[model samples]
Target: MPLPDLVRRWQPGWGRCRTLPAATEVPGGLRVVLGLPGRHAEIFALDDQAVPALAERVAEAAEPTWLTVPTTRPGEVHIALENADLEPFPDAERLMTIELDDHPAHPVPNAYWAKTSEFRGVHRIDLTGHDGTVAASGLAAIVGTDAVMHDIRTDPAHRRRGLASAVMSALAVTATQLGATTALLVATTEGEHLYTRLGWEPVATMLTATAPMSALVRT
Candidate 1:
């Protein structure tokens, strides 16, 4: 699919995956009212050309907001955001996707137990340690034929144990069982290493900017 059309399909599922309000389409892209501390809302620009306008919009707002643009050249997007008085966050994330059929099986490590559950339309998996502590976890939400994955993470104390991979596998199984054929997620640079190993391909780099911390403090 074209990147633009892929983004259009991806955004709403992302919001649903996070249980956030539906995204609203505006002049440049889609906006979601996040309303969290240090984050009042966020706008996902359709492309680089939309970044400047979205940056300017956030710059004039009293509430802290984030602007995320998907592009290969984050340096240019960073410069445009700086020009608009927005602070660009370092280490751009990757927008990744995979055909569920291509995802390989990763069994839960012998030391951990995997549990999958669903609530409010979101499917969740938890990898609990042998001692019963939660070691890693992730969630997926099915939207039509696609499944959006969110917040797949392992505890700092549990690195290098294949727990993260187990969490991902469990979530994928749940999503596929629920009739989803594709999977998508925004992954950190560190995460890209793991997803790529699991057959997910990068579609674009995601550059994010927010109001400067100093400015947010006064709001």
Candidate 2:
């Protein structure tokens, strides 16, 4: 229902995935991480009140950790840090959750639909044009009962032709076959508008963090 819970559903096959205080109670308190060997940490339902304590715990953990929460509450930074500038993402605060009923009906040439490859349960699809160039591409990763659609992109020359929608439709069909009932993704400003038209909703905002060099190098 809520966006954070929706995100937690998509994370699968991890060493640690549970609520901070307890599983029975939830509002803003879930920690989905592999710890130690994990590249980063994702914690949801973590209200600002919990961030300080959470940061302390992280400081004492097996190693330095970069905690990313849906809210701007900062466990990795001193104060709340939202990438309004969209440093790496280029479109800030536009996280969306999507679900399609069966498949969307926007006809594309059958030749357009091609499954390029699949690895580690993630499926990749490409829409190639008559010239055999990759016009659009998307990926779906089925983890547990949740499916995450990611990295949907269309070539600049292929924009406005609905190739992204075609890719999404194909991925949605594949998701159902994999038994995933829900799908989620983080969208950019441009993507948010396109996805909304294709039936996705802006459910929540996302904030991500990574360990700084100092932290990473700390003994």
Candidate 3:
């Protein structure tokens, strides 16, 4: 599928996974009202070509908003800041997808164990330390044939312990059992390397930026 199509597919699942309000379609893309501190809402470009107009629209809005484009386009990023106070965030996110497969059994280390849970269509997996602390955790939500992955994290102290892999394997098994054929997620720079090694392919570069309060003021 095309990059834009994958983004469209990923949005609803992401919203569900995060328990945010449903995203509404806008002239050039989709919009979600986040209502969080320093982040009021977010607009996602439907395609690379829609970014210039979308950025201009974000500049005219009156709230702390984020403008995002799926694929890297330097010219568009420049245009986004040309007439507004938009500050481009680092290019540290990659949208990735993987075909679900039979998750082979993987044993947890002697000092750790795993747990799985589900609630409201979201599946969660956690690798817990021997003392009952979470070492690594991740969430997945199945939307249609796609499962959206979110919040895959391993504690700093748990680094290099393969706990992340264990969590991912558990989530994959859960998603496959839930009838999902593919999985999607926005992976950080560090996560991209891990997911890549696990066979997830990059769909596009995820770019995002937010404007300062002064920039949102309209004359």
Q: What is the C-alpha RMSD of each candidate to the true structure, in Å?
A: 2.5, 7.0, 3.7
**What lDDT would candidate 1 get against the real structure?**
0.84
Decide which is better by TM-score, 1 or 3: 1
Clashes of each: 0, 3, 0
TM-score, candidate 1, is 0.92
- Best model number under lDDT: 1
Q: Please give, for residues 1-219, the per-residue lDDT of candidate 3 as tens digits.
A: 877799998998888878889998888789998887666788987876776677777778787778877885656655555445567775537889888873344567778888888888988898899778999999998999999999998999998988888888888888888899899998888899999888888878777766655333210
**What are the Cα lDDT values of the candidates?**
0.84, 0.58, 0.80
How far does residue 2 in candidate 3 sit from its true spot (Å)? 1.3
* Per-residue lDDT over 67-101 for candidate 2, one digit per residue giving the tens place of the 0 to 100 score: 44554332333343322211112224455666656
Give the residue spans of candidate 3 off by over 4 A. 72-85, 102-105, 214-219
Worst 10 residues of 3 by lDDT: 210-219
Model 2: weakest 10-residue lDDT segment is 13-22
Residue-wise C-alpha lDDT for candidate 1, range 1-219, written one tens digit per residue: 766667777887778767899988878788899788878888888878887788888887788788888887777878988888888776788999999999888999888888878888888899898788899999888888898898898999999989888888888888888899999898998999999999999998888888887234311
